[model samples]
Target: MRITTVETFVLSERQLLVRLGTDEGLAGWGDATLEHRPGTVAAAIRELSGYLIGEDPLPVTAHWQRLTRGGFYRGGPVLGSAVAGLDQALWDLRGKWFRAPIHQLLGGPCRDRVRLYTHAGGPPGQTAAPERARAVVESGYTLVKASIAGPVGFLDSAATIARFVEDLEALRQAIGAGADFGIDLHGRVSVRHARRLADAAAHTRPAFFEEPLRPEHSRLIGQLAASTSVPIATGERLFCREEFVPVLEGGVAIVQPDPAHAGGITEVFRIATLAESYDAQLAPHCPLGPVALAACVQLDLAVPNFYAQEHVIDLSSAGSSDLAILRDPETLVARSGYLDRPTGPGLGIEVDEDAVRAAHRPDLLVPAGNPSWNYPDGGFAEW
Candidate 1:
């Protein structure tokens, strides 16, 4: 079917949906939701708009190349993300046309269920250590991840380091080995400070240490990995598989590709495959809306080198509505700690079109940095 029109709708649900119309009336959906950058991403989508009209919607690869390499200068969040959404819509349309889920097209499922993990909230200090850890374990999550500090600058203080380890030690004592624990350095620590946190948490045998240093310094992650037994996980900032090539080869034990940012299913499928070649695991970074999660699940189902997923509890009202729209969304039904792959067509999701259309560009729908986050010394921190 020939592509007729491509429309981008940024909804009040804090998600961006691209609707690609085909001549045969079969349209596909893809989520290109970028937080704190919706307007910019949407504008990029519009700028990459012309080539899609009248082309065959089924030629996703050709279309992707056209939108990506066909340009004067290619590759960045704006151009790359716009093509990601469009590529997803093309894949969705193809899947629906064949009446199969995305996994079947990728060579069928390697396993029945995909494992997942959730973020367990805690205070800046150890004020609620036992309670928070108990809440996570009691809620039946087999694994929960934590960040020791809100913001950690280079060589902040020995007291800061001591407090973080002390709090984590307390949580580990309370939770024990019944559930696995991990930590996100949040790219706030310098190499030296990161080494310190890794040294302290190494004894606890945390699942993995994530983004110990900035991803741009990913070349050193392998060195950091050698310094500690814990695995290294990053790639939330990563946008494509080509970007992740050196990352996996860098000896990072895991590759975390965010479907929303990493070119949706098309590129993520490629990312997962490349990771498989290196014997690295894939734990997709998805802390966004359900459509994006559904897209992640579809990729997770088909990938052979699958790993646990990062999940987030709904923090806002619109986020709740986003999940409600999915046809077969997976919730935290951890059976000894594993989430099953979703079972629905076309990424296993069904969007609430009317709500999506109504809330086009909903308040707080646009992606902008959160300002409330701050370091202990009153400096701004990354959120």
Candidate 2:
């Protein structure tokens, strides 16, 4: 079938979804949410659609190369994310045409079910982190990741370090030895503080420390990894295989690539294999929407190196707007901390067009970038 039209939708300012329609009437859906810049991503997708319209949609790899390399200036968040969303839609369309799941097209399933880990967001200072951590454990998840709280100084006081240790201690006590906990520093801490933070968490035995330092500081993370036994994990901000090379050499035990932002299934699969070569685990970063999560799950099932997936199981409970644009939401529902492989063709989830259209609010104004944080002296800090 030939591509007829390419369209984009926004449930809010937070998500960009793409739909590809072919002459044969088959429709494929993809999500290209780029944090707070959904409009920019949508515009990028529309610009790239010029190359896709009226072309045969089956040559996914060829199309991916054309979309990415066709532009003289390519491969930033907006362009990469635009290509990623279209790539997912094309793959979804191809899977449906072949009458098989996307993973089967890759090489069939390597695992029976895909394991998942949910986020447990807590109050500032992480004072109530343990309570939230226990709730996820009680809900049948053996693994959960929590964010570091509030603003952190470049050289925080001993009390600051102690408070973080205390929070981790509380979570360890609340969940007992049966569960594993991961910490997302959000790349807000300096190397000195990050080293101290990782050293202090030795007693807690965290599953991994995510983005302890920003992507630019990946080289120093290996030193942090060597200084402490805590497994270092990063790469959510990185968009391609080239960006991941230094991170892998940095001795990170896990690599977190967002399929929606990192060129979709095609690139993330290559990233997974690259990490595997370094003996690193694949724990995809996916805190966006359902279609992005579904795409990650499809990749997770097809690869042997996949360790776990990052997901926000209940959007409303997470204090986020409800963006359940799926006709069969149950297709993505995880049970006992594991998501059974999707059997339907394509990405294996159906989008509720009416619901998405109703939620679309292009006029909504969301300030770009995360909220800025600062120390008492008003110096810049990472959020």
**Number of the predicted model whose lDDT against the real structure is largest:** 2
lDDT (Cα, 0-100) at 299 in candidate 1:
82
Compared with the true structure, what per-residue lDDT tens digits does model 2 show for residues 1-383?
99999988876555688999999989888888888888788889889999999999999999999998898887878888898899999999999899899999999999989878888777877833778788888888899889988688877888988988888898889888999999898988888988888877788899988898977787787788788889989989989999899889979999998888899889999999999999998999987888888899899999999999888747323222343678777777767777888899999887777887787777643535678888788888788
lDDT string for model 1 (1-383, tens) is: 78888887876334677888888977788877676667777778877778888887766777877887887887666666677788888888878878888888889988887776777657665422556666767766666787766566677688877888777777677678877777877777777777787787677777777777776877767677777677888887787877887778777888887777777777888888899898888988877666666677788888988888777745223335446654333442345445566556676666666666766764554455554777666777765
- Model 1: residues >4 Å from true position, as ranges? 12-14, 125-130, 313-322, 327-337, 362-368, 372-381
Query: lDDT for every model?
Result: 0.73, 0.85
Best by TM-score: 2
TM-score of each: 0.89, 0.96
Q: How accurate is candidate 1 locally (lDDT)?
A: 0.73
What range of 10 consecutive residues in model 1 has the weakest lDDT sum?
327-336
RMSD after Cα superposition, model 1:
3.1
Relative to the unseen true structure, what is the C-alpha lDDT of residue 23 in candidate 1, on a scale of 0 to 100?
80
